[model samples]
Target: MRTRPRGDAGQAFPIYIMMVAGLLFLALAFFAVGKASALRNDSQGAADAAALAAAQKARANFGLGFLNSLRANALDAFLIAPFAPPCAEAQRLANANEADTNSCTPTSGYLRDLITVAVEGRDPVDSPVLPGSEDKVAKAKATALIEFRCPNPKVIDADSNGYPEAFIFTCLSGDVVTIATADIERPGLWESVSRTLFDVRLVDQ
Candidate 1:
């Protein structure tokens, strides 16, 4: 019978141990990457929801008879600034998604109809897949836009039908105009046309 030398004894055991350790390291790295990817997705989702909420509020703005261009009370919407309600809406939505809102800024593009939202996801301290992610936070940004399709108010008619078509107002300066219902040829059937408002869903940026 041949006996194994002392120096060579259990050498196979060390190699096996090393292989197992390497496998475990690879598995941990894969898990960490997966966890981080999931967190990043969550952050982006939260940002989108926040931005959409804010934009919806701004889209609700509208002006009624003799208000947009004519002088009237505050029961109307102003295109000059629509920041506060939308910002508050964004904050509420971000909180619901377990994210903290960093900023809600109104951006330039299409005049003042764009809103941008930034949020940070809560750190996953309890993550089993990525232990170190507890100290790392996920962040994302999104933009929501309001697109207006305004019908030319100057293209007036007696009613919905194009009758008594040509009408002009000296006081009106732009496409948006407000005039008395009596001024319309068919006062009883007259309808005021303003900027048609709608919102585009959030886009990750």
Candidate 2:
């Protein structure tokens, strides 16, 4: 039986170890990249939801305000709109999507009609794939917009003061109007004009 040199006995051991280490590193890198991507996607979803939520809230306010105008007809209440800060709605939506809101603000040049939101993923992952990256969290941003088109809104000028008091609306063909104090005394004289409300929705731009 021939005995190999002690030094050569394990010469291949180092190469094997190096190969294993390299493969392990590659795996870790892949895993880290995948984790980061997933977190990024989650963050993006959160941001989108948040922005949409804010826009939806504004839409609701717009509806209510227009309805009130149909009742009061004294002022264009929409000017004072956004009954609630859109950021609050965004925060709520971010939480639902397992993310925290980094920032929520209305887009410039758009009055309560557009919302933008930035968000971060909720939890930090302990990643061995990317050293020192474990502390980093995923972030994403989104924007949502709203617009309305009143095809043929009949502006109500009940007071004849040039300030519209209300708008007359009809879901299909029947007119719906709120009874005013004067309307109680004399029907159909001071009520809002019968017209179609604006078609409102979320827009990509």
TM-scores, all candidates, are 0.66, 0.67
Q: For residues 38-132, could you state the per-residue lDDT of candidate 2 as single tens digits?
A: 99999988888888887777665554445455456433445435544478888998999899998876643322356778899876766876667
- The parts of candidate 1 lying over 4 Å away from their true place are 1-9, 61-67, 70-85, 108-112, 125-132, 155-196
What is every candidate's alpha-carbon RMSD to the true fold? 7.6, 6.6
- Report, for every candidate in turn, its global Cα lDDT versus the true structure: 0.63, 0.63
- TM-score, predicted candidate 2 vs. hidden true structure: 0.67
User: Candidate 1 residues 1-205, lDDT tens each?
Assistant: 9987977757878998999999988898787777778888999999999988888765553333224332322212444444444688898999999998999988644334678899999966335556566688889999987654432334345554434334343222334344543453343222343322233566555
Which segments of candidate 2 are over 4 A away from where they belong? Answer: 1-9, 70-84, 108-112, 155-205
The Cα error of candidate 2 at residue 48, in Å, is: 1.1
State in Å the error of residue 138, model 2: 0.6
Error of 2 at 69 (Å): 4.0
Following a full C-alpha superposition, what root-mean-square deviation does model 2 have from the true structure? Answer: 6.6
Candidate 2, residue 148: the lDDT equals 40
